[model samples]
Every structure is written in structure tokens, then in C-alpha cells.
Target: MSCTETGAALHVEGLCWGPRPGLTLVDDIGFSIEAGSRLAILGPNGAGRTSLLRCLYRAVQPNAGRIAIDGVDLWSVSAREAAKTIAVVLQEMPGDFPFSVRDVVMMGRIPRREGLSGWSELDRERVAHALSHLDLAHLAGRQFATLSGGEKQRVLIARALAQEPRIIILDEPTNHLDIRHQLEILDLLRTLKLTIVSTLHDINLAAEFATDVAIITEGRLTAFGSPDAVLSPRELSAAFGVTATVHGAAASGGTRFSFSLPRQGSLS
Candidate 1:
């Protein structure tokens, strides 16, 4: 509920990923996130945002490049150790398991254990804290499959918190939530004392929540910097193939934007 100590920094260099031999989905994209800073990855469909994120969390193998946390190579560590440092809340829902909400959240503690005997006192305390923080205490006993989309998203976030990670990676964490829930979730993420890297669909939400923004188009990074610097109309137009207008800055609040189709039918 209160602000915690700052988290680790993230560095990505020359990252590339692809399924086939010659076709790259994420092409030499690179960026860095300072400790406790929040970064929003923005791009149109097929822009490799998800692919780039997947490499960070080890969802897929990258053909080239490096990911480091606090100057340590991420892939060099064991998977369990990596889980301790980074937790992820992805877009897809878990399969319908007959687990209770508490059971689902307790899974996050698995990587913290040294042996598979039983839950430690620290694990219980973390689960309780995460549930209370995310407002899932009342629903702790409910079946996981019965919750609404917003509730489900919160539950997943609670699970991620239970991991006690230094960095949190989310892929479209606000997907399927109503406007109110979207704002609430983003607000919560922004306050956490952990490094945040998320892919966001709503440009306005990115403007509101991100300390830094990365714009990718056609598998390449076009921009990376403070939201105000990277989200200019020219960058937006180039990345999205649309004419864009900017109203204000996200850092000082009241930032607004509008978009329209380009009259020229081609980008020059």
C-alpha cells in the first residue's frame, strides 16, 4: 500500500527474434529502463511490440542480442532466479483450472521456495499482502473461473506481486477492462517501486502512465525517450501511418491527442 524501495534497471541491446531463418519479428530493437522507472511500449499491430516483450520475459528465444537487469545478464541466470527478479502478467488468461483464487496467487511463490515441502510464513504474508493490496481479499476463496475480466486481471496482478519481483513485465495488462478499471490498474502499476515494462494499446494511457515510451514500427524501434519527446505527432505519424496531433505533455498532466488518416496515401 505504501511506496517501496526502487527496483532494478533493465537494458536491452540489439534484440532480435524470429521463428524462421530469415524473417525477423523483432529487429535489432534496443532500449533501457532506469530503476523504478515505468516504460510503455507503443506501436501498431505487427510492429513487434509483443515479440520484443516476449524476449524480455523469456517466452521465446531471441536469435540475437542481450537482456540485462542491473548490469547482470538475464539469460545467464537460472529460470527460478530470473523469476525472482522479474514477474509477468500476460494478456492470455490461464486455462480454466478448478483452483481457488488464493491457490492461483500462491503459485507465484513457487520460485521463491528452496524446497517443495509447504508454504513458508513469508509466503503466506506475501500472499496476504498481495491480496489485500489488490483488493482481492474478499474474493480469495472464490473460484478463479467465475470472476469477471477486471477481477481476473487484478488477481493476476496480485499473483505477480506475490512473486516479489524487482521488475514487472506486462503485455497489455489493461486488456478487457472497462475504462475505470483500466485507469485503476495503470495507476496501481505506476505507483509500484518496481521497474515496469508494458505494452499498451491506448496511446492516451501510454501518455498518462509512461515515464518513457518506445515506438516500434515494422519490427524496428523508431523512437525511445520521455513520452513528450518520443510521442510527437511526427513520430506517431511515421509509426502508425496516420496524421496525429498532440495537445499537452504527460509529465505535467492534461496531455491529449487526435489522429486522422493521411491524405497522401503513402509515407515519405
Candidate 2:
């Protein structure tokens, strides 16, 4: 698959993973995202959305298949090397850290720091830029644990930005935020230059935010393509086991969706 001319290209083929024998959580998933694109993975609970992301971000090694970043096998590179190109924002935040916000963001530079030399001018500059870009500069001195959910999420994203990676991977980025914060975070993601890969439960948000969408269910990829093609009523109904309807065109402002559970003992 061809990605955009900017950012990094990511390709996964025949990806499969599971904890041990006789069980598989991710099965033969394959897709590619070009640079500067957002790919949203959607599925019901326990449908392996998180497992797929874990494989992509190297949090867990796939039992089979290959992941290539910018045309190089991900496994061929060291963890430090991979960290230079891929940054990750997880769903959970650290319970408590005595460090201030600035200190938290500075940690992103750890991958780039040379042995025994400590942080350089570039590190400081990137951290400052990230803080300003995320509008967290005003809160830089605040204790991390004391911030609101939205602020904490932004801080985590700022930390990812400070890494200066070509691709950023997140798992359920909007999970715990309120409606306003959800939109804020998604809007922030749209402005970023990096390739974005994330899992979201909200189908409408995925439709609005993603350049491409992949639907996974039962550890398999059910659909993959532009949202217009992949997010049809049929696909949604099958993947989510709901009666799905699409309203409005993507070009006419935005596409919206509504879903209801299928009637018991009745096939429509």
C-alpha cells in the first residue's frame, strides 16, 4: 500500500499473536498506512483491538508475520532504534509521580539521549515546543497527578510529541474523557504531522477522525479501507452485531451513524 509523501510508512502482514498455545487473540491481520494518515481500529470489547495495537507498537511480539516501518523490518532494529521513530501513548496514566509536568515531558527525550551526556539543547527545545504545542506550557509546573483527565491525556500526548517520532500509536486515547475533551483530543490529533494509529470505541468519532479504518472482530480483520468504503451499514452491523445506519455524506460536513441492537429471535 502507498502512504502519503510525508511521515513514515507502516506495513503489517500476516500478523498473529496469543499468550500461549491453543488460543489466538490477533489473527493474520494485515494493513498499511501511509505517512501523515490516521488509521482507526474499531471493534467490540474483547475483539482484540488492543492486542493488535500492542503488536504494532512492539509492546508484544507477534507470534507470526512481519511488521515493517519505513520499509525496514521492525524486529531487525533495536528497541532504542524503534523508539526513535515510534512513540506510544497508552490508555493508563501513571498513578502518581512526584515529578512536575515539565519533568514528565522531558522523559520522552530519554530515547534520544546519548550515554552519560544528559539532556542536550535540542532535548530542551523539543520539550518546550511540545509543551507549547499541546497548550500545556501554563501547566508545566503543576504536579502530574493533580491534573484533570483531559490535562493528563494532553500531557501524555505532549510527551509523545517530544519524542519527535514519525509515527504515534495510542490505545483508546479518548477512553475516559468527557465529550468536550474527546473532541479536543481528536481535534488535536488532526493537526499533528505524524502518522497516527489508534483504537477507538466510538464509531462516529472514528469516522470523523480517521483517514482510514479497520474493523477487527473475533481476532480477524473484517474490513480495511477509507472510511467511506469500510464503514458501510453492512460492515458495521456484522462487526458490532447491531442494526447500523449511515446518515449524511462525508463531503457534506461529516458522516454520522446510529446503531441499535438486533431484535431477539428475529432476522431483519
Candidate 3:
């Protein structure tokens, strides 16, 4: 795998979204991430982390705001054009598809297909590369539904990689994997040159994998910066209503964290 693709910069300003009037799932939010940066979104459940991601990937339209990719308005482009630039790996795995892993990965090339032509040589090459990149070459012949949970996740990621997008957005990419697979997946993601935006539940993992972090709560962005700067005990405690403690420096690659309920009468 080669890390040669230069990722695009992402910018969001005054973003808001909701299903109905007076109900906002993603409040006014603003942030910017440089090219090739990995951004981890963290917050308590229903804090709108996923909602914010949906807005960024154009899964759902924001009520108002601007989303720019490399200074180009994201909304100004067509869905097909956006698909060519942005790939998404959702948390929910698809239902048992009666297709082989290779077939599934080939679907990623749909956005790049020209007119009604068949799959081109470039599509096959990309699929093969994605399979090898994710270490799924041997499993390419296997039925996708028969694979284990971790394998399924890898296949989904490989599909995303086949899309050859400048930016990849994931909703809990490590959801079904065990500790080892989680670490492996995150390590692989760190090596990719693409811009990564993911919603992660593990604060420590986020600290380890993200080049930058954005903490969202109550549908608003409360903190955004390097893990060392934003993952402070104060911010964690305030955002999660827990006692947070940082145990190691990020530079050491051993930045551990511990969290516990606040003491009695602490909530006011």
C-alpha cells in the first residue's frame, strides 16, 4: 500500500441539522482540519457525534452552514462527484449479501464508472489493490456473509479504500473488532494518506490514533485540538460527567486514561 494520495482539507462553519423545526441534532458547529489529518469525534451517546458525521458526509443535509473541501463548497457538487471524493464506512454492517468479497469491493468503483460501460481495468486493479491492502486477498473468494465480525469490518474498509476517496468518514470503525483487531485497524488507518473523520467511543484509542480531536456534546463542539490539549481531565470530566485522569504523555505512545463517576453531590 502506498501513502501517496494527498488528502483534502475540510472546513465546517455554523453547521446545524435536525429532523424537524425546534429540534436540532447537530447544533451550530465550526471546525477545520488540515489535509491528511485524522479527526476523532468523541462525546456521550446522543451528543450528536454521528449526526455531525452525517452532515459532513452529506448523508443528511444540514439545516444551515457551509462545508468546504479544499475551499470548494461541498454542497455545490453533485452526489456522484462527492462520492468520488469522499468514502464512508458506516458502523452498521450490511445484511448477508449473496456476493463474494471481491464482488462487494468492486461496488466501490461505481462512482467512477463512466456512463453505462462495464468495469474497466482500473476498477479491477483498484479492487485487487484494496483486497491486498486490507489483507483480504485470500478471502476474496469467500462469501461475505460467512466471514467473522472483524473480517466484515475489514472488508467494509477495503471497499472504502477501493473508492479512492481523498477523505474517509467512518462511524465507529472499530465497533465489532476485538482489542487486537481494533489496534491493527487503527494502525492501518494512521498509515493511509487520506483524511480520516471518525466517531470513536474509546478516548484512549482516539488519543492514540487521531492527529486532532473534536469533542462534541449536546450537539455542540466544546473542544477541538491536539489530544494533549483537548483530552485534558477538565474537558473529559465536563463533557462526560465523570472524573477523568490522564496517566501518560501522548509522545510516549502510552497515553492511558481512567474514568469514574463523580463523587456524591458533585452534580449540581
TM-score of each: 0.94, 0.96, 0.96
In the predicted model 2, the residue pairs found to clash are 3-34
- Among these predictions, the greatest TM-score belongs to 3
- Please give, for residues 77-145, the per-residue lDDT of candidate 1 as tens digits: 888888888899999987686999999899999998878689999899999999998889999999999
Each model's lDDT comes to 0.89, 0.91, 0.92
Candidate topping lDDT: 3
Stretches off by above 4 angstroms in model 1 are 1-5, 248-252, 265-267
lDDT of 3 by residue, 1-268 (tens): 1123678899999999999999999999999999999999999999999999999999998899999999888899999889988999999998679999999999999998999999999999999999999899999999999998888888988998999999999999999789998998898898789999999999999988999999999999999999989999899999999999888777877778899999988755
Writing each residue's lDDT as its tens digit, candidate 2 over 123-153 gives: 9999999999999999999999999999999
| Least well predicted 10-residue stretch by lDDT in candidate 2 | 1-10
Return whichever of 1 and 3 wins on TM-score.
3
**Candidate 1, TM-score vs. the true structure?**
0.94
Query: Which ten-residue region of model 1 has the weakest summed lDDT?
Result: 1-10
RMSD of 2: 2.5
